[model samples]
Target: MMYIRTNQLLKAVILLLFAVFLFLLHETGEIARFINPQYVHLSQIASILFLFLFFIQVPRMFTNSEDDLCGCGLWGCSHGEEGRFAMKHVISYGLISLPLMIGFLFPFKDFGAAEALKRGVQYQVSQREARDEASLEKNVQELLEQSALVLHRDNFVSSLRALMAYPTRFVGKPILLEGFIIEDCQDEKVTVITRFLVTHCVADSHAAGFILEHEDSLGGREEQWLQVMGVLDVKQHGGVLLPVIRVIEWEEIEPPANPYVYP
Candidate 1:
């Protein structure tokens, strides 16, 4: 009888955690954009509910004298037969939940959410267009100026795909990118990391690629925007050559209005 009740209590806690996780994920961007000012009241109400359950469950768990809190069937809960409460469960739950809570905070805002990835590229294209407005006035000047026409969004995506699909060393090809200083590890070199953005949302972003030869500016503050001019170059690391956009000349720039790029 003690074991069955404890099992039910544990199931309730798990279900609560799962529901909260789903609720927050679904709310993603709108989590901050609360439409109702009274939502703060809603949050407080939810907090009260959690605290009420916690207060009850914790004491109950502490007082439990079950012979099988974990279970005793195919999944034997008999790891401990003692009537005394075990903090092992508490510690285990905390360790497990902490990371999952952190998971709720990803793909990280460093790169604007995945939507930003598409927008940043478009924004860049737009800025390029704005900067070139005067060239359209000059017929001969237009011929000399190689504007990065939106050839196609897919065309730009293909270049990114090439880098992703071919992670090996590459020789320099014409490349243009803008980002801020992550930290320059460059010595006689100018090693720096420009973000290769892949994001699902602003919360959970991943970064890729580095210009080691350009480590000269690697130690700059995190997330400083830079416009890099380079060619594709391949470097061998850990027995594999990975392609990198080799730096030619890099200049600092103001960050775009929308600052993330997604794959």
Candidate 2:
């Protein structure tokens, strides 16, 4: 019937549009804003696969009636829903298409300090084996030799992990690092320099960083990226000893191309 053919064509157009949407996200490299860098290759593969499926579905749009066989020319062909028009089906299709529409209309944003607050920041490190401790110390030493204990974006997660694990080992040692501001206390003199640590992807991202103690107020610095140079110091906070960064110098910096640090 003409009605069946029209519905089939509409479905095919929707499928084609969804495929194009995903393909564009991958092409623009904006997919990283939503997903982990490690899984970018998988997203790329999915985009290609979607486009391939769209091409296969294109033939259905021209057919005046359902084909007795699928694209593979085999028996037991299936055209999902087969011209059925029900509220449930319509709602389901709308839900499926909603994300595509939103992505097209809204600009992609990297997760920021507001998201970090909901997730909370973690800084404590647990005990490690003697051999592991030695290896970690050696690695830290190599980084320490690079003046002011500079931490690069590439190794930010691992280096911070090492520092957290062995706070005493790194105490009095100066460090240079970068992260966005996280409001932590009523007193505007102190704030947390926080990084989003993504173990697998953005879905699992968690805030990680050290408490920064500065004489200057942090009233207007919330969510702003800052490069901090300081010495690691142990301070008593809330009746517990915690590692704090005694900030010697800090400056506002532009956000990095890839804002999330992978563990």
Candidate 3:
């Protein structure tokens, strides 16, 4: 009886912890800090389910002593006379609760240029389909004809792709860009302007950016967000010729609300 009661208490606690985890994600509006913004509705649904389960477990703790809450005959409940909560059971639950405990202890952090460099930035963008190259080039030319080819959050990834795909077409064309600085090469004259390209979620996220070449060193600019108004210059870096920004005007800026750019 005592073992069953203890097991019920542990189960209730675990359910409540799960509920709180979901609640905090939504309450703090930090859900965007982890996953893509589009999937926030799914997180909302899961939080509701967890809260419902938590409430169900709360009443069960007082009404039933020997009843199995999980209802899985294979685990968590023992019906026999020798039934006892073993040390392994506690260890298993502890392991299950470890992630929740760690989340509470640490501040939520988003993956940035540091993680981008580790994954390696995509210097040259490629298209698998031939038609895409032509269409991308045409659209880029239209944009470049404007006063300045500005790259905004919605079309940032696509703009970079088009520019990288046809470097010569965009060479010397005035452009605008925003991203964090990442420097991996020995030379300090150039740095990568990187953004997290998240396809589905942060786990599948990777960094994408182009090289920025300037006469002055980008010292003390590491991991800082900046907006660059420049013209593309085809330059050689790491034996590959890619578009490098010849910066005309630049200034530091705050990181955007949604750091990850989606496809």
Candidate with the greatest lDDT versus the true structure:
3
lDDT values, one for every candidate: 0.46, 0.73, 0.75
TM, every model: 0.40, 0.82, 0.82
lDDT of 3 by residue, 56-146 (tens): 6654444233344333232233343124667888798899899888888887677876787678778776546335767777767776777
Q: Count the backbone clashes (under 3 Å) in each candidate.
A: 42, 0, 0
RMSD of each: 13.0, 4.0, 3.9
Residue 241 in model 1: lDDT: 51
lDDT of 2: 0.73
Models ranked on lDDT: 3, 2, 1
Give one digit per residue, the lDDT tens place, for model 1 in 77-136: 444433434688667666767755675665534342233334422201124433544442
What does candidate 1 score on TM?
Answer: 0.40
Error of 3 at 92 (Å): 2.1
For candidate 2, list the clashing residue pairs, or say none: none
